[model samples]
Target: MTQTATRDDDVAAGPRASAERQGDVRLSLQGVDAFYGQIQALRGVSLEVRQGEIVTLLGSNGAGKSTTLKTISGLVRARQGDVCLEGESIARLPAHQIARRGVVHVPEGRRVLRGLTVKENLELGAFTLKDNALRRQRLEEVYALFPILHERRHQDGSLLSGGQQQMLAMGRALMHGPNVMLLDEPSMGLAPKLVTEIMRIIKRLNEAGTTILLVEQNARLALRLAHYAYVIENGEIRMQGDAAAMREDASVVKAYLGLGD
Candidate 1:
């Protein structure tokens, strides 16, 4: 099926199809479908992240979790359905255009510039801005949030530890001044201690008023930090609800989260 067709299916299947709407939503994905060649990667995945809330998308590998983030960021164009930022459709916008609209995507693998200094990488993030003072101001803010990057400002991003590189990636995204941050596997490739540290950062960012749409394989941590969440499987959303409720759901606990009954 095409992107639009898939999105339509998602709208029909979504749990909230008949629920009474409430609160201000920041990002809304209605019936979004994505494909890689002939194989469908995402099938009608509908979800929402409300203003000032941390919403987690939890699933196993190949469950279309990353595809969902890419579609929302305009890195992968949806074949069907709409991706709305505050109720305005952005599906057709280019990736850079979408970024300009305050939707910053920190992709999986923490794609930091290995050759550039931490400060230089951050400067590149503000390329869309013309005002030097504003860019410098934002850079200071990111440095403040991640003091290690400031301490190693002159060091190349490649020289930082994995945890520090992840922090740098997040700081680079923040330099863009996004209203909604789409984080894909922010806890990937980290030790248990580092994972906890990253999760704490996610929570802290949300608490400080940044709306986040987090995709994670660490379902336990994701749900713990999220206000609302969706569990996606085989390119479709299998379950969704308040994060606490999902944590209590037997299927969610046993399957995606690897928790005992």
Candidate 2:
């Protein structure tokens, strides 16, 4: 059975109804398989991320969480099945082409341009735009979202703290005005306080109507912020459900999330 698209009305109702609506998926993978040379990284993985929601990919290291994002973004092509964006197939599209269709990926590491000034780094995000006016407008919007970036506009990205770098990474992605933001480990390598701050920024972004697909090691934090989540194991989805329920699952609590039993 195909999954359903989740609407704003469904979320306020409850989790079960939300899951049912999500079962009618928006961005869907139907038996997707991917490989790197002879080693298979993904094995018939199927999942969904509805529009206007934060869906998290939760799992241990090497569980193909990163690979899933790459495949969806067209950085890695699928060997089998299909990847659809709003019911249109993008499996054959290149990474840049997919990104042009409003799928922006922040990647695993905070890959900010180390030597570039914050303003320069953000300018790079508008490289595909032909309209100078539009680029400037978007840049101003990004600065508004992240005032820190504007404060350090002339400072080199390398000089910023880890939290600040993550913000810059996200700010760069926002320059394109994406419909879906694929964030890989946004909380990685930050102090606890900074992590909370970053997650709050993500929440605020979602509240302002940006859809997010977050891949994070901090399960507790991710689940709390996400609408739905998938638990990946050995390159496949082992469990999928509402985020809050997954957070309470005993196995998930003990194994991947490091929560008490």
Candidate 3:
């Protein structure tokens, strides 16, 4: 379910308020190609996320959405391509080095550490920070963003509900004071109410000026929330457009948005 690739407008005139936040390019991937053993996972994939904008990558399962995120975060190497952060090439950097550069990846399935207390899991995210005062300040900020986590600070992260775990995952990422957040399926497997809550938090994060690259299967929601979007299939970018145009695209509505089924 891919439409012909379209260019993303410099300014997204979408209904989302974040359109006004779009600024200089914060992250860019140029002609990226990746492989897992003998299997190719990404084929000349290219995309860019602007400062203070929420850009969504849409695809079904195994469409390389997660792989794309991994590549940006340096968890998966780009076999042939340029992954740049603010005009500097980071393609060859190690995962930790990339993290130090402010690219945070909140992986799918809410990978919260089961044995660690909720607070402990969050503190681990600030490992790179050397200043205790800054770390404490960041911790307070995360707690404020998620009061439930503060309430459950003593409890193991895995003991929390699905939504709570998702909060914990996001809280952990926020601790790093990330420049760009690559969120993979933040809404997966949550109840409808919880989904709405998570989406609201994501919106809040963006409004507070965190650049985001969101990979979501919920096309209707993604299109509604994002400033811009890219659709990929079989490891190739098949479509790209501002969210407003994408929501109105007939092929996109039928395929990802579940219309005309």
Candidate 4:
């Protein structure tokens, strides 16, 4: 079973502060279907992440949440639908191509390079960019958001604590100035304090104009940060609505939030 983290003290109980920051659809998956060899992972999954919005996907383990993200980032090719970025079809593009188009995926497990310095790992994220000046500018931006990474810029990426690695993973994605980011299970395996810190940073990222599609294990925390949400179950989207509404939903409370009087 997938373990879920509870909301930090700072995570509020209602609508996110950035609820009004939504814009036109920045990314959309229309009836997307994906498979691994013979096993179907996503069935007619459709969703949207509007510009400047923090949208989250909530579900249990093996509920196709990660697969939905993979499909958007082109890590998993869609067998029968469209993955559109700003109204352009990108379902058939390769993962690298999708990333170059500013669809960054910060997958689960942190995935920091074992031997590379923190700076090098961040530099890898900017590989798609050709301008040296722009790369340096982005590096500074990342450092500003994660000062610890700046302190350990020369240290090995794999040597950082789990929380720091999560920051590095997120900071690395920001290196390219992504139009839309697919964050899968970011708060997994984190201590409560670190989870609070990560969620705060994620909120800051959204407030700073980054469009995010988050797949989080902490439903209450995810709902707290998100402007809107979707709940996936058994390879399909079972529910979607404004984040505030879902938080008060009896079904959501019982199944995901575990809240009862």
Tens-place lDDT per residue, model 1, 19-47, is 33345899999998899988999889899
How much lDDT does candidate 1 score?
A: 0.81
Which clashing pairs does model 4 show? none
Residue by residue across 97-192, what tens digits does model 3's lDDT show? 999999999999989998999999999899999999999999999999999999999999999999999999999999999999999988788876
How much is 43 displaced in model 2, in angstroms? 0.6
C-alpha lDDT of all candidate models, in order:
0.81, 0.82, 0.86, 0.87
As a TM-score, model 2 comes out at: 0.89
Worst 10 residues of 3 by lDDT: 2-11
Model 4 lDDT tens row, 176-231: 88999889989889988888888889888887889899998878778778889988
lDDT of 4: 0.87
The deviation in Å at residue 24 for candidate 2 is: 7.8
Write the number of the candidate with greater lDDT, choosing between 3 and 4.
4
Q: How does each model score on TM-score?
A: 0.89, 0.89, 0.91, 0.93
Clashing pairs in 2: 3-23, 3-24, 3-25, 4-23, 4-24, 4-25, 5-24
Q: What C-alpha lDDT does candidate 3 achieve relative to the native structure?
A: 0.86
